[model samples]
Target: MLKNVLKSVGEYKKETILSPVTVALEVLLEVLIPYFMAVLIDKGINTGDMTEIIKYGMLLVVLAMAALAFGALSGHYAAVASAGFAKNLRKRMFYKVQDFSFLNIDHFSTSSLVTRMTTDITNVQNAYQMIIRVAVRAPIMLIMAFFMAFKVNSELATIYLWVIPILGIALAFIMTHVHPIFVRVFKTYDKLNNVVQENVHGIRVVKSFVREDFEEQKFKKISSSIYKDFTKAEKMIAFNAPVMQICVYTCMILISWIGANLIVGGTMTAGELTSMFTYTMQILMSLMMLSMIFVMTIMSKASVERINEVLIEVPDIANPEKPVTEVANGSIDFDHVSFSYSQNPEKLCLKDIDLHIKSGETIGIIGGTGSAKSSLVQLIPRLYDITSGTLKVGGRDVRDYDLEVLRDAVSMVLQKNVLFSGTIKENLRWGNPNATEEELIHACQLAQADDFIQTFPDQYDTYIEQGGSNVSGGQKQRICIARALLKKPAILILDDSTSAVDTKTDAMIQKAFIDEIPDTTRLIIAQRISSVQNADRIVVMDNGRITDVGTHEELLASSKIYQEVYYSQVKGAADNE
Candidate 1:
């Protein structure tokens, strides 16, 4: 985990190195000041020599200013290095998510990924800054102060050794108890963020159902969990300060008592005893800083593990070696394919799907909600790899093609009908970045979207809210269809994309496909039989299996399931009339 995280410090290596170097210089100068004060006391003040006092005073002033300068430089370098490191880490995680296949995303979930990038990264960034500056300064100061005290009087210095072991054991116990609680708290944070995201995205449904109080309670529950866990962890860490204070004061009392006795016996001078008191404070203060570093490290350890999970995750789908670059045509062949979202054969969502589609053919797929109509078409673009068996696009295994080339050749307008926040022109250009105005209008016309777009003041240039929130359901579907049309792909899959449009408009869009792009293989998935009645062939799916395949008339005559669906729909229409 440490190795992976440090790789993000690519360009900031110089600043990372300089921060600790400057901190060491600051500590060194600070340690020397107390020793020089001892010289000014014994050689100058006690000896009543004005020259010695003034010379040592000036030297001490220079050391103090130099220490301040180095301390400020270290702070600046540590800040820059930590912030830049965070930027690089976020960039790497985002780019890695882009490469993740649908299966990969399902494993981590959207809310968890968002939490890892945001709150978790902030924790790691703060920890990095402390590690470079305070962490470096603490140990160096402790050792130097203790060494100087030993040089002054070896017997008195041994007091710190007894206190050191006791303080170390206390801090170790606090860190061990707090770390697991912190880990659990961050996981609760993921749930809290997930709740907020779901509430905002579905605010319309929530309001329509008048569930405001319910949402508030749900949010409070998760928030309360975090608060409780954090409180417990903090209560444990609170022991650190009092424990350090006990050790600090005990060492001071011991040093003062012993040094004064030694001074009275003339074994130690007044100057040496005064310096012993300063070294006692310095050594104990360094230990206090070290305890704070331990606390920060315990909190950030969980965050580091979460971030490393994203950084090292291998995308489940990738372009194979020596991949086929170009798709020959829109032909798709499913040869005994079986798929399970969980990759377990016992829980297969699609099973043994043997079907053949030629280039330029128009196919319609109809099925009940759980029948896997969308699953069959999704394999063409390799959005999710098949669990078993061969699935081919343009006469080659989908795994054999480069991911980008294969997906570009196949255009899919999914059931969700998403449109980003941008001008309509900008959103449509996702299909073809270089599409001309004429090409844009032509595709919209084919999808039966051009008429409504022209009614808006800006027409194609009109701004669309995120997810096309300002538009009606039918309008969003039509705009999405037009965008897919701009791709001009060999194969176009509409996964129940036109469900919101009226029958007349739906028929017109199908007619446009038949007239303008007859050579493009079109697979239309719909609930209405009227939408697919004129297809070259229609497929009926049930319970993850294809139960019937024929032209519309043949299925109506022979397939019992198809006949039942057709008669029910026809009776409903007649009743309406």
Candidate 2:
């Protein structure tokens, strides 16, 4: 755990070193304050000469003021440095997760990844801050306190020999009992995040199905788990303050008893005894601070382990060694490609899939619900690595090109649509950052979005709510299509993108694509036969295998799979109309 955490922080070696250097400077000042108290007591109070007492007293004042200035300076530096480290860590983790292929993402849920990025990052943040300010100071103050007391009187320092070990034992017990709860607490957080995330995203489905009561109960189960685990950890740790206080009080009383006897014996002077008492108290306080740091360190260790899991996740799909730079032409071929989501590999998502798509051709992929239509398109973008076989994009192996270059050559409009909160223009600008107003309008016109967008008072400049909540399903799909069209990549994929639009609007949108995007190769996946009827070729799929392939007319005549799809969907559409 320590090795992994240090490794991530080590990525910013200069910043990591600067952080500790700054913090150590600040804590050095704080450590000196108690030392001045000893000096003031021993030099000024015990001495009879007013001149010597006044001189050292003024010097102590100067030291205190200087320490304060340095402390403030160190604190500012630490905050800036720690914040910069955390920002870099967040950026790296986000990019790494994005770089991960689909099969890798499948190993962790969306909610879990969110928790890793957010809660786990905060956990690391707290530790980073505390470690900078407190970690070294606690131990340094502890050692210095004992040395100061030993200088005043070795006998009095011996009292700590007994008390410190008992404090250690108590702290050890707290650490042991709290460690397991920390692990369980993260799991509870995962459950809570999953429930809340799903409920919020799928609120419409829950309401339509009238499952509000069921959803509430489901949330209760997860939330209750979080409450229970958090309480358990808190209860165990709460014992530390009172237990440490009792130990300190007991030591204080024992020291008073021994010191009183020494004072009566005239062996220990009044000023000497006073300084010893102050030093002992400083030692006790420093020990408390040290123990608290240890507990915090333990908590962060657990968090670090969780975060390190993600930080160390090696994407199965390696980035290209010497990547291709040129824009790939819209041509793809799968040479006996076989793949699965899992290493234990329960069931293959695609098996022995061999297909060729020529440049500028339109291919419609038809499949049953689990027939891997979306999965097949995912391969062209290299979202997942094939288990066995060669997959080529533009005559070169897909893995031979930089992922950015490969992705830039293709655009995929997913079945699950998402839109950021921004003006329509801003959201669409995501597709083409340098696009002009005219191009935006043309793309919107092609996606059949211009009409609805213009109905609003602001048109293209109109603001959209998060997730495009102000729009209907068809409207969102059109906007999503417009965004993809603005990119104008060599290959365009519409994965059930037209499902929300009526057949007539769907046909109109298809017409716009054919008219305007004449040179781009297209792949459209849909359950409706009409959506694909005009495609250059159609591939019918079932249960992860290609069952038939041909043009619309050829398939209706010869292929059983294509004929069944045509009969079911075309007949259904005709009856509806």
Candidate 3:
């Protein structure tokens, strides 16, 4: 996990290396200052030698200034390295997500991924900064200070050995108990993010239903759960400070009492005892810093695992070793194909579907809500691979084709029309970035969107809000259709995309498809029979199977499912009239 995460340290290695190097230099200078102070106090102050005091004082001043410079440099380098690491991590995770197949995305949900990239990465970044600076400084200071204290007097230095073990055992006890709570807390954070995202995205629906209180309750529940977990973990971590303080004071009192006796007995000097006191503080403070490092490491360990999960996740879909680059035609052949989102044979959403379509054919599909109408068309573009049998597009297996090449040849406007935050022309250009102005207008006209767009003051330059919130549902659908049409694909699948538009506009859009793009194979999925009634052939589906396939009039005569749907719409229309 550590190896995978550290791969993102790409160009920041220089700063990462420099941080520790500067910290080591700063620590060396710090260690020397205490030793020189002992010399100044002994030979200069005690013996009344002014020259000796001046020499050591000058050395101490230079050491202090140099240490300060290196300390500042370490901080700067640590910040740069950690911030750069986080940027690289987020960028890599985002690009990896872009390459994820639908199945991979389903495995790790949107909310979970968002938390990993933001909150989790931030935690790791902070841990990294501490690791290079404080983590390096603490251990080095502890070892060096202990060595100098032992050189001064071995008996007082032995006190640290006993205190170190006591602190270590206490820290270990706290960490082991707190780590599990932190893990649970982060998982709960994912739930909290999910709740906020859902409530924000559906705020209009929530408000229309007057369920603000209910939404608030939901948020509070998740928030409260996170609060409880964090509080529990922090309570355990809080024990660390008191434990460190007890150990620090115990060492100080023991050294002070023992040193005064040694001084009276003519064994230890005043200057030497003073230096031992300085070393004691340094040793104890380094251990305290290490305890803090331990706490941070425990917290970020869970985050590291979460981030590494994303980093190491192998995308389920990738181009074949030798991929077919060109689609021969719009002709598609599904030979006994079966599929399941979970890739489970027993849970298939599309089953034993044998269908063939020629290039430039117009086919209509009608089905109940869960009949997998959308699932069937989604397979053609390799959105999800089939579980069994062969799905051939342009006379080659879908897995054999380059993902980009196949998707470019087949444009699908899904049931939910999505528009980004941009001007109308910019959104339309998503289908073809280099589309000419005339091409954009022509595609819009074919989708029956040009007339409405021209009414806007800015026309094609009109800015759309995110999700096209500024536009009506029908307008959003028409604009999406125009965007899809801009692809000039060999195959176009409109999966109930025109449902929001009036039947008259839907008819005009279909008519334009036939007149303007005769060579493109079209598959239209619609609830209303009138939308597909004029197709060359209409397919009636039920429960993941094609129940019948025929022209509209033939299906009306023979297919019970088709006749039922047709008569119900006809009866509903007459009643409304």
Candidate 4:
């Protein structure tokens, strides 16, 4: 885990190295300052020599300034290193997500990914800065102060030997108990994020159902759970300060009482006792800082594990070593193909799909929900690889071709139509970035979207809200179809994309498909019989297998499934009238 996380500290190695170097320099000067103070007190003040006092005091002032300079430099470099490391870490995670296959993405929830990128990374960043600066300085400062204390008078320094062990046991107990609570708290954070994202995305449905009160109650429960967990963790960590205070005060009182008696006995000098008091404060203060560092490290350990999971995960999909660069033609052949989202063959979602489609053929697929109609088309683009058998697109195995080359040749308009927030022209250009204004209007015209688009004040230049929320369902579908048309792909698959449009508009879009782009192989999946009535051939799917295949009239006479669906829809329309 440590090795994986440190890989993202690229380009910031100098800053990371400089932070600790400066911190060590600052600690050196700070530890020496008290020693010089003892010298000025003993040799200069005791003898009533003004010259000796001036010399040592001037040296102390110069050392103090150097320490301040080093401390400031350490702070600046620590900030730069940690912030830059976080930026690089986020960038790597985001780009890794982009490369994940559909199977890879299915394993993680959207809320979990968002929380990891934002909150988890932030925690790691803060912990890293503290580790480099405070963690480095505390132990060094403690050792230096303890050594100087022993040099002044070894007897008083022995007081720390017992106190240090007592503080260590207390801190270790708190960290062990608090760490499990912190781990649970971060998992609760995932649930909190999930609630917020779901509520915001489905706000219209929530308000329409009059469930605002219910949502608020749900949010409060998760929020309260997080609060309870944090409070418990904090209560445990709060034990550290009191334990440190007890040790600090006990050592201070013992040293004062014991040293005064030694001074009166003419064994210990007053100047050495004073310096021992200063070193005692420095040693105890260093312990306090170390305790804080341990607390932060415990809290961030869970975050580190979560972040490292993403950084180390290998993508399930990648391009072939020697990829085929070109697609031969629109022709696709699925020979003994089978698929399952899981690795176990017993859980196959599609079974034994064997079909051969010629270039420029228009095919329609119809099935009940979960029949894997969409799954069949998805394989052609290598969105999810077939578990067994050969799936070919453009007469070459999809896995053999470069991923970008194959996907570019096959344009798929998914069941759930999506449009990003942009102008109509800008969204259309996703299919073809260099598409001219003329080409944009032409694609929309073929999809029968140009008329509705021109009705708006800004026409093609109008801004679309996120997820195309400002547009009606039918308008969104037509716009998406227009976007797909701009690709001019060799093969186009529409997975119930026209369901929102009226039958007349659906017919017009189909007619335009036949009139223009005659050589493009088209696969249309729909629930309505009329949508596929004019296709060259229709495929009926059931339980992950093909039940029947024939043209419209032949299917009406021969296939039981097709006959039932066609008549049911016709009867429903007649009853409405």
Candidate 5:
């Protein structure tokens, strides 16, 4: 845990040390105040010197005011530094997540990462503050108070020093017990977060199914488990507080007992005995403050380790040592391509697939629910590398091309297209930032989105909520298509992107696309046969491999898989009519 804490600090070397140094000055004043109090009590009060009392009392006030000023300044700096560190850490983590290939993202879910960003980062900030604020102050006060006690009477201070080693042993025991509980507690917190996220996002589904009670029960089970784990960990560490307090109080009792004997024997004056008691109390109280920091450090160590896991993950697809890519036409060839997601099941997503798509031709990929259509498209853009075969984009192997170059040549409209919280023009501009008004209108026309967009209150200036939730499904799909069309790439992929639209709009969109982009190489993945019937070639896949390849008429005449899907869908459409 301590190692991880040091590592977390090591990453933010610039910001971490400055605040502590500023705070050290504030802590020095805290230590100085007690000595001033001692001087005022002994040098002024007992000796009956009015002039000395007023002078030292005024000095005490000045020191206290100075202490307050130091505290406010240091506190402002510390907060600024801590918040800036957290911001930098989160931004770095977010970029790291972006750089990490899909495999790393799959390993950590959306909710899990959210918990790491929000809850875990907060723990680190808290730990950082405690380490700066209390850790420095407590030890300095402890040392200064001890030295003062020994100056007044050496015997009483010795008794206080003896209890220190026992406090250290008790602390060691508490830390030993805290480590495991903290690990379990963090996991439990992630689980609880996931459950809450699911329940909230799918609250409508839960209500529709009338399973609110069921979902609530499930949440309660996880929540109760988290509650139990957290309480258990707190109690394990909480035992240290009472135990340390008892030891400190015992030392206090011993000091009062021993100091009185010295005073009676005329070895210690009354004022000297009083100063020793105050110093003993200061030492024990400082130890208690230090104990709180110890407890926080134990928990934060786990959080830092969790954060470090993300910071160090290197992406599989990074800059190549040497660059190589040259292609004019958009052509794709997959030779015996095979891939499986590294996670559970390990079922092959694409198996022994071989296909070629020519430039200036439209290819349709038709498949059932789990037939690897999306997986095949993902490989073309190299979102996930093909586990075992050769894939070439534009006559060159994709791996030979720089990642940016390959992605630039290809534009894909994913099935779940999300628009940011911005104006309609802003989302479209993401596809081609340099596009003029005429170019934007042309792309929107090709996408069959110009009609409805112009109907809106602000037209192009209309604001879209994040994920385009404010718009209808069909409108979002058309906008996504417009965004893709605006890119005007050498290769374009629409992965079941038109699923939400009515058949008429889908047909109109497809027609405009064919009219405007006839020479642009395209791959259309759709469930409906009518949508793909006009494609130059159609590929039919079953399970994970392509089972058929031909024109619409050729597939109806030849492949069993293709024939079955076509006739089933055609029959359903006719039955509905």
Candidate 6:
């Protein structure tokens, strides 16, 4: 986990190294101050030499200023290194998510990923700053201070050796017990974020159903879980401070008692006793800092594992070696293809099937909800790989071509129409970034979207709310269709994309496809029989299998499933009239 996380510290290596170097220098200067004060008190005051006092005091002032400079520099570098490391970590995770295939995304929830990038990264950042500064300073200060105390008088120095082990054992006990609780706490944080996200995104439906009370209850349950876990963990961590204070007081008293006896016996002077007291505080304070570092490291260990999970995950999809660069045409072939979202052969969503579509042909597909109509078309863009058999686009295996090149040649307007928060023109430009104004207007007209767009006060530049909530369902669908048309793909697919528009507009959109883009193959998946009656050929699917394929009239006479659907829709239309 440490190896994986350190990779994101790119370019900050200089600051990372410099922070500890300055901290060590600061510790060295601090250690020298106490020793110099011992010289000033013993040789200058006791022996009545004013020159010794003046010389050591000035030297002490210079050492203090240098220590201040080093401390400030270390703090500045630690801040820079930690914040930069966090920024790079977020950027790396987002780019990695972009590279993941649909299969990989299914393995992790949207809310879980958000929590890892945000709360988890912040914890790691705080811990890293502490590690570079306090973690470095503590040990160096402890060693240097202990060495000075022993040099002054070895008997008082032995006090620290006994007290250090007692403090160490107490800290180890606190750390081991609290770590598992922190792990549980962070996982609950993921659940809390997920609840908030779901409520916010589906607030409209929740309000319409009057489920605000229910949502509040659910949130409280998860939030309360986090509170309980945190309180328990903090209670365990709270043991640390009291234990540290007890050891500090015990060591100070022991050192004072021993030094007083030694001084009266004529072996130790008042100046040496004062220095021993100073070293005792420095050593104990350093031990306290180490305890704090250990506590932070335990908390951050959970965050580190969560972050490394994302950083180390291998993208499920990548371009093949020696990939084909071009797609010759829109012709597609599915040779005994089968697919399962779980990648398990026994639970395939699409059964072994064979279908071939020629360039420039208009094909209509009708099926029940689980018949895998959307699943079939999604394979063309390589959104998910087939589990078995060969799936080819432009007369070559889909896995053979570079993924970007293959996807660019195919445009699909899915069953769920999505529009981002931007001006109408900005969203349309997603299809073709460099599309001219005339081209944008032309594509909208073909999709039967130009009339409604013109009615908006800002026309093509009208602002769209997030998810296009400012527009009606039908208008959102039409705008999405226009965006796909702007791509001018070799193959155009409308997967129930016209369900919101009136029958007349749907017919007009279909007619525009025939009149304007004769050489581009079009695939229409719809539930309405009227939508597919004029196709060159229609496919009838049942239970993940294509039961029949023919022109509309041929299917009406020969395919039982087609006959049942066509009559039911016609009967519903008659009854409405």
Best-matching candidate per TM-score: 3
The residue-by-residue lDDT of candidate 1 on 21-98, one tens digit each, is 999999999989989999999999999999999999999999999999999999999999999999999999999999
Between candidates 1 and 4, the one scoring higher on TM-score is: 1
Q: What is the lDDT of residue 522 in candidate 3?
A: 98
**Collision count for each candidate, in order:** 0, 0, 0, 0, 0, 0
**lDDT to native, each model:** 0.94, 0.81, 0.94, 0.91, 0.82, 0.91
Of models 2 and 3, which has the larger TM-score?
3
Candidate 1: Cα lDDT at 309: 94
Minimum summed lDDT over a 10-residue window in model 4 is located at: 309-318
TM-score of each: 0.97, 0.92, 0.98, 0.96, 0.94, 0.96
User: What stretches of model 5 exceed 4 Å from their correct place?
Assistant: 1-15, 325-327, 343-347
Model 4 scores a C-alpha lDDT of 0.91
Q: Which model is ahead, 1 or 2, in terms of TM-score? A: 1
Instruction: Evaluate residue 10 in candidate 2 and report its C-alpha lDDT on the 0 to 100 scale.
Output: 40
lDDT string for model 4 (398-461, tens) is: 9999999999999998757889999999999999999999999999999999999999999999
Model 6 lDDT per residue over 279-374, tens place: 988998999999999999999999999888888888767899999999898888999999998889999988988999999999999998889999
lDDT of 3 by residue, 1-577 (tens): 8988999999999999999999999998998888889889999999999999999989999999999999999999999999999999999999999999988988889999999999999999999999999999999999999889999999889999999888889899988999999889889999999999999989999999999999999999999999999988989999989999999899999999999999999999998999999999999999999999999999999999998998889988899999999999999899999999999999989999999999999999999999999999999999999999999988999999999999999999977979999999999999999999999999999999999999999999999999899999999999999999999899999999999999999999999999999999999999999999999999999999999999998999999999999999999999999
Instruction: For candidate 5, give the lDDT.
Output: 0.82
Task: State residue 338's C-alpha deviation in candidate 5, in Å.
Answer: 0.8
How do the residues 309-423 of candidate 2 rate in per-residue lDDT, one tens digit apiece?
A: 7778989887677899876588889899877767434578888898999988899998889999888888888887777788998899988988888888889997677889999
Q: Which residue runs does candidate 6 get wrong by more than 4 Å?
A: 43-53
Point out where model 2 deviates above 4 Å: 1-53, 343-346, 570-577
TM-score of 4: 0.96
TM-score ranking from best candidate downward: 3, 1, 4, 6, 5, 2
